[model samples]
Target: MGILQRAKPLSNIGAKQVGFTLIEMVTVILILGILVVGVSGFIIFGTRIFVESSSIDQVLSQSRFAVERMTRDIRNAVPNSVRLRTATGGSYQCIELLPIDSSTSYLELPIYPDDALVSGTVIDNGISINAGQYALVYPLASNSSGVNDVYQASRNKRFELQSSSSSANVLTLTFTGLAQFAEQSPIKRIYFASQPISYCFESPIGNSEVKLYRYADYGYIASQPAPSQMGTAVLMAENVSNNLLLEPAIKLTEQNLMRNAIVHIEPRFSVNGETFKYQHQVKVTNVP
Candidate 1:
């Protein structure tokens, strides 16, 4: 009787031990595998979207920097001295500001876009700041050939370099200066107004544009991008394109200041194929 009772309990236990058969176990594992695959796929798709979105944002930010820098220079444009105007295109960006400095008796830029004319060299008209500090951006050059063949320059010293059209191809602007500022005088500097560009991204559609205006009665602590002689360029933007629109407006003042610089820049592309458009208006100023 005891043996029969033990066998009966054993049988019951054996029956209850059927948690899952080999086939059932295989089925459960297959189901779990499917779930895992679906979850992983979802994660990968989400990650891809996030990466692409981030890339688009980055492009916009970089382009805005380029625009801000350009506009800031335009606003702080050196008056009738080193003026920036919208000619037919970039070709005439630095036209006849006449002389390189406030002192008027040095050179003559007879044409719209002046050319720097040395006896044997010709440089096209571009922007000119101070005498020793000026930039002449010419049009696209053809191989060894240059853009235009004549320009204008001036200095505090009374000397004018001119050449005829026959020698015009040889005519160009060249510069050299000599100055000995007062030493041990706290390294003094001239007061010049500055209009710096401040950049920001507002929306996904347009990420590279900003508001442009002048900051007159303000001044920049010019430092160096190169050495102590080369001043640091307060950069507002980078990654810019041809949508380079400039709308100039002036407010009532003793000297008409460029109140704002309005610009519309195109968007940047991303790996995931997204595009955006941006319009920016920036304030420019040269302050004390």
Candidate 2:
């Protein structure tokens, strides 16, 4: 009886050690499942945060670059050439400019005593004259009238070089779209060059998103009633903010023949249900 009692206790202990109860196994599996879920949630949260941060960085980089480029171009634009107007059927904003690329003195006056210098106006060969290059005639004479004479002289008188006479060291010029200038005796002391630049906002079809565009090589028109379609456009930035009355606003001032402008922009983007915004202001000072 004593031997049997000892063997029975040993057998019971071995049975307990051999396998877990159903309740114990279930508790262990539940604990493991909780741990796995916690780890997975943490990893997903971390990855989402990384993606959002990267998206914000990209938006900031693109906004900064676009704003800086526009600022630089405005600062270097021809005096009194900055103009802001509504575009896209008056729903969007556009900023037009005459960016002075280069300048040179006039070699000689049109054959002289000509009515509006119809065709054969001659310019100095020293100036780089490409076919279809826009040119402005700026007289050197100081106006006693105390008016902005240089700005007045160049306005509405922008022309294109029809051809260059390399043998004669002169460029033949043509007027653009009914632009005609009367004979001014002081034409000998004049400068000529090209300036063309513009910025616009475009809204795509079936979308609320807007894009900023830059236009270049747009020849001078009598007036830019519609500037968005004026030249070859390049996309500057996408997803521009339009929450304000004027998303991209411009204000120009002229004092003592010098021109200046204030440009304000707010760029916005969305990422994973979160919206980001960046505001920038740039002051542009122009040369006379």
The C-alpha TM-scores of every prediction are 0.37, 0.64
Shift in Å, residue 177, candidate 2: 13
Put down candidate 2 lDDT per residue, 190-262, tens digits, no spaces.
Answer: 3345655778766655556777888876554445535445756888887665632355444444334333455
Q: Number of clashing residue pairs in every model? A: 44, 0
- Every model: Cα RMSD to truth: 16.2, 8.0
Best TM-score among the predictions, by candidate number: 2
The lDDT for every candidate, in the order shown, is 0.32, 0.58
Residue by residue across 1-288, what tens digits does model 1's lDDT show? 355444443345436343778999999999999999999999999998888777767766655555555455445433222223333332111111122222111133322233333322232233233332332222111113321111111211112323223233232443343221111112111221112222221121255333222222122212101112222323333333323234222111222333322233333323345544455443333221
| Prediction 2 global C-alpha lDDT | 0.58
**C-alpha displacement of 186 in model 1, angstroms?**
32
